[model samples]
Target: MPPDALALYATVILLLPMACFFLSSPTFLLVGLEIPEVTQLLRGLFNGYFIVMCVAGVASAVAYVISGRPVFAVGALAVAAVAVMARRWFLQHMDVELQARAAGEAAAVPRLRALHLKGMLLNGILLATVIANVPLVV
Candidate 1:
């Protein structure tokens, strides 16, 4: 397969989950996080997102390298690195916040909501970046 095609497919893999979450996340807002299931579901969704992004990013990096686009390869690697760090940070903080909410702290729900919003915002930025740079790569 052509390197450009490889990159395109790899990016599509990355974008698929991102677009899912981007659309689904706001729907989560339609419901409240006060429900235990909703919080856990959101948490699980984000965990999955991070994992998928790591795989997709590496795939994209390999594609970029094969295409002789080393700089884009580096960007892809950075995306993977960011996902790795963000995963750890998110899981840790999520656990603490979950515990706090479990313990009846008033602020925990809002914090979770903030995390949700931040994730959405970050995902949007990444999606925009990928599309924005497609002209250069393809």
Candidate 2:
């Protein structure tokens, strides 16, 4: 396979979760987060997002290295690193909020929403950063 093709696949992999989030997030606004099933679905979505981000980042890094773009490789690695750190932090905080909510805390649901929004915000930033690098790869 060609280097460019590999890079394209990597980029697509990285962007896919963001694309899904764009469609999935607004629906969260309509649902009651207090529902156990809703919280479960939301948590699953977040878990998958982070997992994909980690995999895509590493794939992109490998693609960059194969394509002889070591600087971009470093950037890709950074993306993966961020995903790794963010996943641990995000999930931990989320679990805390979920537990609190289960325990009948009034503020827990709102706090979870806030965390969701922050994750979405980070997604936007990452998407923009990845797109910005596309031209250089081209």
Candidate 3:
């Protein structure tokens, strides 16, 4: 691909996750409000967000590689891996805890909250990493 095209691709890839991060941040904060219906809706939204992250990460890595920037490709792949981990492990466990809490297991509430906090922290880190890579890749 031409240099200009590659730059555009890189910019789009970077922007995808940045957009997702900004949009999802508010939902993360609202997780603590303890509205079951809203929480359920947010859970579905987060699932979509994580999937988008993974796809965008892979796309960014591939674009970087095609653009002859292997280091940026690796960084992008790392961000994708983090998203996969959050989706497969953190989110999965959070769902389990939520179910348990719903079943009247009071102890699960704190655990669920902790997991939510961890998810938010991970998301912040991922957003920062992606933002930092934008200039390097683009």
**Cα miss at 64, model 1 (Å)?**
1.4
Estimate the lDDT of model 2.
0.85
lDDT order of candidates, top first: 2, 1, 3
Candidate 3, superposed: residue stretches over 4 Å from native? 31-33
lDDT of 2 by residue, 1-138 (tens): 888877777777777876787678778879989998998888888888888888888888888788777888898888889888988888999999999999999999999999888888888898899888778777
Candidate achieving higher TM-score, 2 or 3: 2
Please list the residue runs of candidate 2 whose C-alpha ends up more than 4 Å from where it truly belongs after superposition: none
What ranking of all candidate models by TM-score puts the best one first?
1, 2, 3
Q: Per-residue lDDT for 64 in model 3?
A: 78
Model 2 residue 95 CA deviation in Å:
0.8
Which pairs clash (backbone N, Cα, C closer than 3 Å) in model 2? none
Off by over 4 Å in 1: none
Model 1 Cα shift for residue 88 (angstroms): 1.0
Cα deviation at 9, candidate 2, in Å, is 2.9
lDDT of 1 by residue, 50-96 (tens): 89889888988887788778998898888888888988888888888
Better of 1 and 3 by TM-score: 1
